[model samples]
Target: VEVRPNPGGKGFVTALGGKWGWSGSGRAFVPQLVMYAGPADYHNKPKKIDADIETYLVGHGFNGFHTIVCCRWFDINEERSTRIKGPAPNPDPRTFEALELLIGKVHSAGGMVHIWAWGDESRRQTPVRLGGKNGLADLRLQRYIAARLGPIPGWTMGYGYDLDEWVARKDLDIWHRHMHAQLGWPHLLGGRSVGPNRYRRGAKFPQIYEGLDYSGYEQHQPTYEAYVAALAARPKRPSFSEDRFRVRKPSPYPKKDYTEELTRRGLWHSTMAGGVANIWGKYVRRGQKTTFQPYDHPEWIKTNALFFKGRFVKDMIRDNQITDGVCLRRPTGEHFVFYKEGAESIRMDLSKMPGSRRAVAVDALKPYREIDLGELRPENQTWKAPQKSDWAVAVGEFRK
Candidate 1:
């Protein structure tokens, strides 16, 4: 489907168009990370894979899947190391088959897919190693991808995971120019910015690349302020947080890094910052079966349901000026959202709006249950939460 920037220039709108924040099917396109287990997984256990996808879409509130298509993560082929002495390597038919099946499943289930064509270790797949002296081999490879995956609806494309590290500016420009022309379909195209500190220059990629339809940011542990700053830096198009601190088991780091509270805060912070979408990273161990369990994190499911399927989500804009805490509000000031980390009460300035409004306090720890604050006035108001934990307040008309 054709996805373009919304009229506001901060979000995306699909061919089935309505307003910003909604996908082609008129659903909020919140993406969740899904690691692929190679073509064999798709070929060998098609029914099981389909069931897993269903769980993510229906059981969980996610409507998008951010997946990798090639290179190290996906053992598509040995062409990268072999460095064959001929024309550019042809697209792997097996990869194509696997993607086709996966894409079809997501589309049928009413979800979108964001495809990362390569990963951090994909430099060898490009002309940097394949001897495409004039860049013909790289162009050929990309064109094959465009021709095969372009026609599919409900998906977007990214050059790779950490693009700023190895992709040259000249090559990026060339690819943008050629791929836009070859793909006929209106799938959005952009690359993930390298994680912070990789280059001394520190992420010089433009907020609005020439032919790209969106901007992306990747960070291992992005703070709420960082998410706000990144989206503020790229106001021209829809911005996506491709990678955040992952929620994984077996402690990839020395400490228990991925707590439920951490994930919940990231989700709300990113959404309140005007991010069109963000991915929830899930690290899977080698040879471990993929289990798409939404119930693993009940807090996440509740947060997703409250925001994406909520009433005011369509009109909310980041407005920290409304309160001391992180906030989002409607342009008309009729509705307001205030989020405070570990604060029992939040003060909001609604004096200008001048009307009675309903307020609901949501404890971040137990979002499934909300405390009603009864009716509140448009004057300056402070709503106290039931406890002094991380909390969010919804003012004005809100979904129960």
Candidate 2:
């Protein structure tokens, strides 16, 4: 199955222009630069935009903005009731110019500016408009704009959450087939090789046009991983790793004390990036209203940071790596638990925890409590499920 890269794993932007993840603490502490304030509030008419951005970049250690909220980018299909209203006849340069100024300010202050994509297929307010060329022309237009703007060098060009609504339209299977046929990729590489101009890693988005090069997938890891693998396997693709920028409340969803769950998910093997992550607004419109709840606190931040250090730092901190080690049971205290990292030998004590019925699979925790012994990897046999967790009370166990 396809999987997303774990965002929790501490990694650095590398020399090969690819993000290499490993278990460790990341130095760049990320804070949420929520773009809730209107352009007037940031521009010189009201306040100094560049000075504000500089304050955050140099002073607060916040390096990125989550969105450009209320920027009039979502005017697509305005006549439709689900959309804004009426025909969105023209572009609002005031709003666009303000964003441009904000972006420039952020860049000047040594910060990365990304588009908080609020567009939709229904609300066709995308800067790169889709058209007759099967939407390929729209993509090309986006590329042209990127070419004109030149490269933002350090900025991460990532879209807002609903990325599936954007790319799910592309026939990946079809794209793969034609590209592979053109590239003449080797059969040993898995896909069929057809043409003579064949080469591995064909021309792709980042090379063609640089807009929206990164994906901010706000869900589980599986889908993102699958996409990256597919893109990499194609004729030629850039180093693309999807980011899990948002997700459901890890547990006890919306109970406020879910910070511990944040510690768990962000610091666990499940996440590919670092522990420090920020999600904008509330989960939805009905349950919790969009209140200005600023998540600004040091105790909680360090609490997360400590947990982060414990996971990422193996020797220096408690755990070998932030996203490493074994979690024998689901934190929600559900059935069927083990180290899910495909690691063979992991130590855990499931004795103390409450259990109605217990069975531990010898190989690994599969979906149906099934694991193939023969298919198990050779190297993952270092840590076995421990008889007793050295630090915790003893819980009973049974081997299935």
Candidate 3:
């Protein structure tokens, strides 16, 4: 069904507000973190997923989080009569019930949810075959799924169409539009996993596609320095990281090593780089402990619950101006200049900044004790990191 624009000639709009807009905070751009949970978590065993969310990722400091709900293709594709039947196109009632429950929990927790489905298979870096043989049948399936699940508030849907490179296909865009017109929620497209290649692929898309609202790239455990640089140079659009967590060969880094500080650091690391961090919940495999349980890791709980107070460093620096270079500033009067880890100090030129600004050094590890660099005037400021260990200094009009 080709969806025509509304009477005003504008494209489809959702109850969530404009198709593309900043999050509630007004400053944060499409702030979210995606995570995948198995069927059990959403089924009768809802307590575990709920507990992990309430206890670990939400409240206190972690606000405005979005987790993508991923499921096995077979789970939603199975038929009734409690039998393995052919072409069960409609969403199973049991699965819909579970999804309804899960969506409610996500809303109550002050977070957004997303349904993840793979696009029709094509020869690519990672081929995903979701919509089977008949294209029209697949469209009907998607339409039925959308009509049933569309009204769920504060959620988005994404089709894994591109993986690790640019495919330049129009079918993906068509699918996105169909979903948007049917579901009334903006859909996301694009994925180029790995460092600069991800952003490179995203840049080539033709400027205007009616329904495309956001794009994402997956970075498998990229260093902070590299992540920040790539995001700064990428296209100026709302971006999300499909995968940002560290993973080893056999299993993901265990809880102790994948500490809370590390998790929070990774999140900010991506956000500061102008991208959203998808917190991979399925971290390690330890005999029935296959998925991410933030409570299990002491550091994950401790750091996430309290560290990185509301826009601490971000409030000081300019948005989208964060670069590895010595200086960062915005016309709004925010300023920042910091040294990477292992750097003693950097000679910064402050002539461009206004006079009488507050300068403070931030230790990424111990955020509580922010050392003040005293009243800084516009000049060649030679600032040193007090107490070392990866320090950053922000000189700007201080906000309370």
Tens-place lDDT per residue, model 2, 174-206, is 332332344321110011111111122432222
Error of 3 at 212 (Å): 3.7
The whole-model lDDT of each prediction reads: 0.61, 0.32, 0.46
Q: Estimate, for each residue in 32-132, the C-alpha lDDT of model 3 and write its tens digit.
A: 44354544446766786577566544532343333332223335433212332344433446666666677666656655555555432343211123334
CA lDDT of 320 in candidate 1? 77
Among these predictions, the greatest lDDT belongs to 1
Q: Assess the local accuracy of residue 15 in candidate 3 as a C-alpha lDDT between 0 and 100.
A: 20
The backbone clash count of each candidate, in order, is 0, 38, 3
Score residue 83 of candidate 3 by CA lDDT: 31
Listed in order, each prediction's TM-score against the native is 0.79, 0.41, 0.67
Better of 1 and 3 by lDDT: 1
Per-residue CA lDDT of model 1 for 84-106, tens digit only, reads 45545445667777777777777
Error of 2 at 372 (Å): 46
Q: In terms of TM-score, how similar is model 1 to the real structure?
A: 0.79
Higher-TM-score candidate of 1 and 3 = 1
